[model samples]
Target: MKVDLFDFDLPQELIALRPVSPRDSARMLVACGDEPFADKSVSDLPSLLQPGDVLVFNDTRVIPAQLDGRRGEAKIGATLHKRIDLRRWQAFVRNAKRLKIGNVVEFPAQVRALAETRHEDGSFTLKFEGEEPVELLLERAGRMPLPPYIAGKRPTDERDKSDYQTIFAREDGAVAAPTAALHFTPQLLEALSERGVQRETLTLHVGAGTFLPVKADDTDDHQMHAEWGRIEPETADRLNAARRNGNRVIAVGTTSLRLLESAADEDGIIQPFADDTSIFITPGHRFRAVDGLMTNFHLPKSTLMMLVSALMGRERMQEAYAHAIAQKYRFYSYGDSSLLIP
Candidate 1:
């Protein structure tokens, strides 16, 4: 399908610069199939879901992956997207043409990296100078990698250290936050528990590629970037049991949804998985693992839009988005969320 089909007009003011106070206070637009869209709050999640339904959350934590550095006199900015190893990372660099293979870029806090091979995707492999854990080096040298749509409007600050992370965040690797989960709070968790809605977690190191636009005119030409994810045998077994027992599996974010789809077989049974997934979900794609999705509003012509379109019908999602915009809901990473069931 044409990428233009997903395009929609959004006002600049609708883009959220920060989260609402008491996280769960953020608005949630419930888009249920063949029903009128319901305007609700994130705190109402317990009531929206059934007792036996399971909500799968991505436990990947966001890292301080943005770095400002220089190669000689040329200033360069790098946002580490994926981990290549303990000492190396794949990053998208600003002014990347100034860098070459084997050139060392000097960054603050006495950190430096050799610009290794440049990938065809326009990102570069940056190998840190020492054996010291690159994660530690990043702590001293990097800032939270905010989505460009938000960062371009304002500067990142100390508040982002806590604001950009979810309560469920644990494993450290993701450059971007699984924004949908940001609405969750301890109170919300307790409420869900009391309501008998079970929660499960999996890891999918969300790379900066999630924010990349689909440059392809047709969906077939777009290539998704690989993200490493893991689903343990116990978790897979439990999820399968939930489905077999006639319960729905709700993915808390696209990160969780994609990982589940990656692990599901043709028969829709989820298997234990520990590998890289670059699943590109479009409207015609059939979903196997998840019954519902809770996610943030996405950008126009973005892969995320396509994923949501696949979950909810394209026409249905288009109408939902139109309602969201008309009602003045916030958009993007720090934005309001939607509960989509199709």
Candidate 2:
């Protein structure tokens, strides 16, 4: 399908600059099967889901992956995309024309990295120059990698150190937060538990690629960037058992949804997985693992929009988005969320 088919006009003022206080206070748009769209709140999620339904969350923590550096007189900006190894990371760089293989970019706090190689797509392989762990280096010199839509409007601050990370954040690697999970809080978790809504976690290090727009004219031409994810055998087994017991497996975000789909077989049984997944979900795609999804409002003509459109029909999502816009709900990474059930 033409990428233009997914395009929608969004008012610039709707882009969220920060999250709502208490996290769970953000508005939620509920789209269930053929039901009329219902405006709700994140705190009301427990009432929306059934007792046995499982909400799979992406526990991958957002690393302070955005870096500002200089090579000679030229300023360079880097956002770590993926871990190539313990010391080396694949990153998207700004001011690439000033960089070359073997040049070291000097960052704040004496943190530096050598430009080892440049990938075809204009990203660079940056190898940190120190015996200390790269995580420590980032803590000293890096900023949280906020999506450009938000960062373009304001600077990242100390508040983002906590705001951009979810309560479930533990295994650190992701450059971008699984924004949908940003609405979760301890109180909300307690309510969900009391309501008998089961929760599970998996890791999918959401990369900066999630913020990239679809430059392709057609869906077939778009190539999704691979992100590392893991699903243990025990978790997979438990999820399968839930489905067997007639319980629904609802992914809490597209990151979890994609990872689940990547691990599922033709029979819809989720298998243990630990690898990079570049699954590009579009309309007409068959969803095997997840019964529903909870995610943030996406950009126009974005791959995420295409993924949601696949879950709900294209026309249904288009109408839903129209309703969301009309209802004055926030948009983007720090924005409101939607519960999509098909």
Candidate 3:
């Protein structure tokens, strides 16, 4: 399909610069199959579904992955997208034209990395210099990798350190937050528990690729960046059992949805998985794992938009997005929420 078919115009003011005071206070647009779009609050999510439904969440924690460094006289900014090993990472760099294969970029706090390989996507592999694990080094010299939409509008502060992360955050690796789960809070969790909704966790270290626009004229031309994810045997068994028992599996975000689909066989039975996934969901794709999705508003002509359109019908999502825009709901990573059931 033409990428232009997924495009929509959004007003700049509708983009949320910061999250709501209470995370759950954000507005939610409920788009269910054949139902009129319903405007609700994120806190009301517990009331939106049945008791036996399971909610899968991505527990990948956002690392302080943004780095400001200097390659000789040239100023360079790097955002680490994926972890390759203990000492190496794949990063998208600004002022990359000034960098070469073997130049060591000197970052603050004495952190330095040798820019090793250049990727076809214009990203570079940076090998850190030291015995310490890169995770620890990042804590000292790196900053949170905020999406350009929000980060460009205003500078990220101490508040974003917690705001960009979800309560389910445990594993450390993701450069981007699974924005859908950002609306969750302890109180909201308590509410869901009271409503008898079971919870499961998987890990998908969200990369900066999520924010990239679809430069492809057609969907077939887009190449999704691979991100690492994991699903354990126990969790896989429970999800399968829940589905077999007629319970719906509600994916908390696209990250969880993609990982589940990656773990699923053709029969839709989920298996234990631990590997990199570059699943590019588009319209006409068959969804085998999830019954519904809860995610944040996405950018125009983005793969995220294509994913939701694939979940719901394209026309339905367009109408839903129109409704959201007309209602003046927030947009983007720090924006409002949406619950799509199709």
Winning candidate number (lDDT): 2
- CA lDDT, every prediction? 0.95, 0.96, 0.94
Per-residue lDDT over 205-296 for candidate 2, one digit per residue giving the tens place of the 0 to 100 score? 99999988889899999889999999999999999999999999999999999999999999999999999999999999999999999999
Minimum summed lDDT over a 10-residue window in model 1 is located at 130-139
Total clashing residue pairs per candidate?
0, 0, 0
Tens-place lDDT digits, model 1, residues 117-196:
89999999999998788889999999999999999989999999999999999999999999999999999999999999
User: 1-342, model 3: which lDDT tens digit per residue?
Assistant: 999999999999999999997999999999888988899999999999899899999999999999999999999999999999889999999999999999999999999999999999999999999998998889999999999888888998999999999999999999999999999999999999999999999999999888887888999988999999999999999999999999999999999999999999999999999999999999988999999999999998999999999999899999999999999999988999999999
- Cα lDDT of candidate 2 equals 0.96
Kindly indicate the candidate among 1 and 3 with the higher lDDT: 1
Worst 10 residues of 3 by lDDT: 207-216
Which candidate order results from sorting by lDDT in descending order? 2, 1, 3
